[model samples]
Target: MNNTTHLPVNPYLPAPLALPLSLVPGKTYSQVMARLLNKLFGPELADGELDFLEGKIMRVDVVDAKLHFSITLSQGVLAAADTKCPHDLSIEGSIYDFLLLATRREDADTLFFNRRLRLGGDTELGLYVKNFLDALELDDRIGPFLQMMNGATTLIGRIPRLAIPKLPFPKLGRRS
Candidate 1:
C-alpha cells in the first residue's frame, strides 16, 4: 500500500484558467514563451547565478499547452530556442503548476513529491537546474515584473466565474 500523504483539496483554490489553445498559433506561443524565458534568465546570467548552466541546455515542457522549448547559457548570454531542440535535461508540468512555482504559491519539492512536476534526461544536470531555481530570489532578480504577474493572477482568481467571458477578448480601454 502507498504511504504517501495526499494533500487535502482546498475549496478556496481557484480553478485553472482555460487556455484558448486553438486560438493561439503555435509559433506565437513559442515566441511568447521564449521571450518570457529570456527575460527571466537574463538577469540571472548577468548576476552569475546561472553560471552552472553554461553550455548546458534545459527544456521546459508545458504538457497541457503542448509547448516545449530549450534554453542554453553560452558566453554569459541566456538564449531560448524558438522551437524544440536537443536538451541535456527536461522538466514537464502543467502551465498552472509551473505558474504556481513561479509565483511562489508552491514549492518545487512539494510539487515533485506530489508528481505534479516531473524531471527527465541527465539526472545530474536536472538536479542542478532544480537547485538553481529553488535558490532563486525572484524578488531580487525580477521583482516588479514578478509582483505584477502575481497581482494579476490574484485578481483573476478573485473574479466570479459568471463575470468572465467564455472567450477571452482584448480590452480596448486606455493603456496603462
Candidate 2:
C-alpha cells in the first residue's frame, strides 16, 4: 500500500505571483529613491507631518534589491543621500516587505514580528518613525494616484509572457 496520502492545498495561503519589472536598469538607487521621496514626502512636508524629521538622518536598506539610501529633512525639505550617513535610525527590509508596508497591506509590527523588517541605531527614533508612519493615512493622502499605479502594476503583472516583435503601428484593418 502507498504510504503517502494526498492532501488538499490550503486556499488561505497566498499564491505565488510574478511582479512586473518597475525599476529602470543602470539607474542608481539614490536617483530612484529621490524621485520616490519627492512624490511620497512632498505632501507630508506641506502638511507639516514630517516636522520631527527636520534634523534627523534616517537610512533605509532594501535588502533584496541591494540598495541603501539616507534621508534627511533640511529646512523642511526631504533630501536623499547616495551613501550611508551617520543616521539616528535605520530601517531594513526586502523590497516586497517595504511595498507591503507602503500599501498598508501589512503592518510594521506584523513584519517586525515575522522578522521580515528590522530596525537599528537609535531605537527610540526608529519607533517614533514607525509610529508616525502607522498613524499616517496613506490611502487618504495619495488615494487616486496610488490606486492608478497599483491597477497598472496589477495589469502588467497579469500580461502573458509573450515575446512578440515590436511594431510601430497596429494592424488597424486586420482582426488579428
Candidate 3:
C-alpha cells in the first residue's frame, strides 16, 4: 500500500493544488532546496564532505503534492539533474511526514518502518543520505529559530478568540 494512500494532503496545501505545485520548474526546486541544504550543512559542504554525492542523482517525491524533483551535486553545488537520468535514490512521502522528520517530531526509523515514508533505488545512497542527516548540526544552526517559533506558537495559542475580529465585506455585482 502506498504511504500517501490514506494520508491527507497537508492542511496548509490542498490536494487539488498538486497540479499547480508540480508545475513549478525543476530549476526552482533545485535552487531553493540546494541553497537550503548548503545553509543547513555549510561546514560539511564547504569541507568537501559531501563530495560523495557528486554525480549521484537523488529524487524526492512529495507524494500528496504530486511533485518530484531530481538533483545532484556538481562542483560542490546542488543542481537539477536531467530528468532522463536514472536517480541513484528515491524517497517518497506525504508533506506532513517529511515535516515530522525535519522537526524531529518523529524519528526516521519510525516513519520509514511504519511505511509513512518510502525509500527505493540504491541502498547505499539511502544510507549516505541518512548518515548525512544524522550528522547535521541542527542545534547549532536552527535551534534559536525553533525556540522562537515554539515561543510564538505558545503565546499565540493562549490568545483569546475574541482578540481577533472578523469584518464583513460587501460584494459588487452588475446592476441594471
Candidate 4:
C-alpha cells in the first residue's frame, strides 16, 4: 500500500505572486533597486538585501551648485561636497527607501514634496544623483537579476507585477 501526505498551507506565509497584484509602485521600485545593485555592486555582492551595501560607498559630497549626494554602502559612504550651496541632509529613513525612490527618473520634485523620500547632504547633490540614476538604463545588466527574481517568485506559484510608486510634487519655497 502507498500513502501520500499533503502539507498544510499557511496564510501568514507571503502569498505567491501568481495573480499579478494590482499595478503598485512599490514593485517598480523593487525592480530598479535590483538593477542599481547589480550594476553598482556586481553579482558577487548580491547575497542579501543589506549585503549589497556592505563596505561600499561613494559620496557625491557635492555636485553642481544646488545638489549633494551622500552615497553609503555596507562597504563605505561618500558625501557630496560643495561650497556655493550648503545642504542639511539627515540620514533617518531606510537607505533602501532612498535607493528605491531615487531610481524613479523625473520623480524627485514630487518625491521631495510628498516627503515620500528624504535626502542627506546638499540638496543639489541629491537632485543630481537622482537625475543620474534616472538616465542610467541598467536593463541589460539588470535583466538577468530581474529574471531570477521573477523566476523564484514564479517557482513558488506567484506572479509579479512591475510598478513604481507615483511621487508627489514638491512644495513651493523649498530649495530645489
| All models, RMSD in angstroms | 11.6, 12.2, 9.0, 20.6
Pick the winner on TM-score between candidates 1 and 4: 1
Order of all candidates by lDDT, from best down to worst?
Answer: 3, 1, 2, 4
Which candidate tops lDDT?
A: 3
- What is the model-wide C-alpha lDDT for candidate 4? 0.40
CA-lDDT, candidates in order: 0.69, 0.67, 0.73, 0.40
TM-score of each model, paired residue for residue: 0.65, 0.62, 0.70, 0.32
Q: Candidate 3: TM-score?
A: 0.70
lDDT, candidate 4, 1-176, per-residue tens: 76975432211112233123322333343344445545564543444433333433333221111222333343432222232333333322222234333333225555456544556655654554556555555556667765655454334333222346899988779676
On TM-score, the stronger of 2 and 4 is 2
| Candidate achieving higher TM-score, 1 or 3 | 3
Per-residue accuracy of model 1 over 1-176 as CA lDDT, tens digit each:
99988763311223343345534554565566657766777767678877777878777777755666676776776666444456777898766567778888888888888878898889888777779888877677777878876875466445543445598778799878
Best by TM-score: 3
Per-model clash counts, in order, read 0, 0, 0, 33
On the 0 to 100 scale, the lDDT of residue 99 in model 4 is 36
